[model samples]
Target chain A: MWTWQHVLTTVFGSIIFPLIIGLAWGKLVEDNKSFGGVLAGFFIVGTVWLLNHGIGLMYEPQMGGNLPGPWSDMALAAFWGLFVADLLEGKKIELEPILSGILGGVLGGLLLFAMV
Target chain B: MNFRRILMGMCTGAFAGFGVFTIWPSSLARWNWLGGWLAAGIIITTGWLVNHYAGGLPNKEGGAWVDMALSIWLSALLGGTVVLDPVNGLIRGAYGIFHGANLGGAFLTIILQLIGATIAGYFLYAARRSDA
Candidate 1:
């Protein structure tokens, strides 16, 4: 029963707000000029929330249901926040970090689906 | 990509995933915006622990994030497919106890996490390819 309005709100609250905060943090704390933090925050939080919302919709109750709550969202935001800050701090991207993130995400998904 | 790092990444990811699963509330009625905050705490703590214990890797290029993001996205698709498709009956059956969620719905909820872990295994191969 969610219309475009609900979707838009979710996007704004879940994605845009985090992105703005990330951008600000990058600028103020990390002095990052490239806005890499914004992108990272957007990608990680956006993907996780969007996917969680989509899955929750498949069930009977669409609103909360099995979707992730603020706990997970804030966790993701903080992770990206530090990640972007580090990137701004001149931390080089390597296969290890990417692999680590991917592996962690997938495992989290599997555990969530199978157990929680 | 070093093989040792890949192994460590898998272990780290699994540990994080386990932590999320443990802290996440079982009932939908208990779920709210606060759950996101809780999940976030678990992820950050676990991630920090893994990085600290496993030995962080060297930095490469910004493109790595692009590749990682793309891979994570694609892996969600893949995980969704695996969960929803009828061919994965065993997995579906195993996961059926969680709120009686249909395959499609279940796929949506957990796709990102699965993709995150799945893509880590292929980082080495993906790194070698020019297109990646």
Candidate 2:
């Protein structure tokens, strides 16, 4: 059964796990702010999870059923972490990045679904 | 926000997405981690080509490329999740599978996709600005 405990676990895990991993990668690897991106990624996922939980509570009981599963959560969190780290280092958004990202995402999604 | 560029981008993205799925089905099935990374490279390259050709965007050397790759990768990852919903629905509907609606999940997914893409865009912008 889905409960508050489950929600709490999902949120906290999303944040803390990435935080620890990012920190470890930074400390042992290169000592960069890449960890911030990692944190951001999980933070986004946690926020989304929390939002889904709230919506579920307010509306239908199974409203959260369509939320991203664990694999997506981890993949997105990791990528976000890298992106945040780049931002902290003063990276700029350009037309190429924006266009490329959208393009990449569409293809990546198709590949993922095909695999599944 | 040029409509022509957006249309071109959509076509490029759709083609790349479908192409990767077709080419690497075996690798994707054998090892997810390696396969995912390989697909990331393909998608990023495709996105870069689209930007360069369709949007007239220029590329820089060094860490800038990494930043571009990362942005594209994450954006694509988020995009994949967003696209999957409609695709899944279509597939299910084709088979006459019925399920209750999860409005909360749908809303959250849209919100998350937007946030995720925005974050990626911000990073890309920052990276490019620094390069300039």
Candidate 3:
């Protein structure tokens, strides 16, 4: 049911790549602890990617992973970023946002099924 | 911060979580685990939040439904863990680990959800102790 391409893409493309981007973004958020864009992080990751590519509009994310054409899910990476932020800040794991994100994800997924 | 509150919360929520998924209408075609868990999560989490805010919430008054909130919170946590399965969100990281919505999978989901909620509770308390 899965090819080598699928295996490789799912592992590296889906998991590892997002993990790396998440770590970087997490570190950035940790530095700016007062920053309020965690929700927006999940919201506007694509625009950040566009800017990170030296589209010449914004400072690169703490580190870069906006590779063109890679199979990436910005929301997943952002969730990991939130996890890392909590860990780095030594704060309570932000359960509310995570639950909310899951709610959004499942609701969005179901809506797609409905549309079809 | 009675420690038993968390434990009691987990035990009750565990059943609530199991019960919510157990009665899910997967046979209905339109209602699958994703929809089931999403509805459950939304209802549980929202109910918990409302309980908090409604009970003199901004200032932390007496008899504010802490245990009930904990149960609801853990129930939502359980729901969150459920939808990550391959059958639902197809969350790649959870693919092999979570399996799908089968018997063995449901058992595993309960256990993992317990662990997840427990860890969250640990963090919540640890932060509280430090704050105090």
Candidate 4:
């Protein structure tokens, strides 16, 4: 049952989050060059979002069928992007990786709680 | 701040992301444990290889490409995690995008995730600093 609600959720989760995160991440990590990172990150995640939607429209599978949960997908994408930024800096910080996920999870959980 | 440190940060982030993806609700039941572990290993290895071979490259975009590679590998890992079949996996994926489509839900999710990353990144960065 794909309703308006579903569409709205999709638009944000798929499109908006990546855009905001890309911008924020770029700004926070890359400073001057975050503009490039933001653009690149947005394009990369946007492509995935489009692909996911396009596939869904083309093949309307069952609910909870093939999708990996949102948490996993976004986390992975962000991790990859951040990884590139970190690598460029040339300083390997061991504890910094999970910090983002944990913080993201807490923030996500709180938001979900508020919504629910 | 240097290339080595940044590479280390990327690797750490990738590993954490892999763990989050693999050892979660799905890990308990529907997901393939062995496959997930194997995939994580491969992603980590690829990160290491990239660092070793491309560490000193003058081009800045190389790092971005590495991030892109991580996304592809993650998509592959996620796609592979579809134990019930591709259609089901995709439908579930749709459900995610569907949720993300909304302003309230999407904004909340993004902000929270980023905040989480920031706090976590700071701590991790600090720990690494102390280690040095």
Sort the predicted structures by TM-score, highest score first.
1, 2, 4, 3
The digit string of per-residue lDDT tens for model 3 on B32-118 reads: 434443443433333323322232112122211122223322332223322234356422111111222223322332333333333
lDDT of 2 by residue, B6-99 (tens): 4555555455444433333333344443543454344434543454333323333322322223333332233332222322321210000012
Docking level for model 1: incorrect
RMSD of model 4 against the true structure: 15.9
Best by lDDT: 2
Quote the positional error of residue A85 for candidate 4 in Å: 9.9
User: Per-candidate TM vs. native?
Assistant: 0.43, 0.36, 0.27, 0.32
Per residue, candidate 1 scores C-alpha lDDT tens digits across B1-132 of: 676766666555555444433433321113544444444344434443344323433224553331222222222222221122233332221222233334453342233333322333233223334343
Contacts from the true interface found in each model, as a fraction, amount to 0.15, 0.10, 0.00, 0.04
lDDT of 2: 0.38
Residue-level error in angstroms, candidate 4, position B28:
10
Candidate 4: segments with Cα more than 4 A from true spot: A1-116, B1-31, B47-107
Task: Give the per-residue Cα lDDT of candidate 3 at A93.
Answer: 47
In order, the TM-score of chain B in each prediction is 0.39, 0.39, 0.32, 0.38
Query: After superposition, which runs of candidate 2 have C-alpha atoms over 4 Å from their true positions?
Result: A26-71, A112-116, B1-132
Query: What Cα-based lDDT does every candidate model obtain?
Result: 0.37, 0.38, 0.31, 0.36
| Candidate 3 chain A weakest ten by summed lDDT | A66-75
Give the candidate number with the greatest TM-score.
1
Q: Which ten residues in a row are the worst by lDDT in model 2 chain B?
A: B90-99
Compose the digit string of candidate 4's lDDT tens values, residues B11-101. Answer: 4434433333333323323434433333333343343334223331111432322232333233323222222232344112122332332
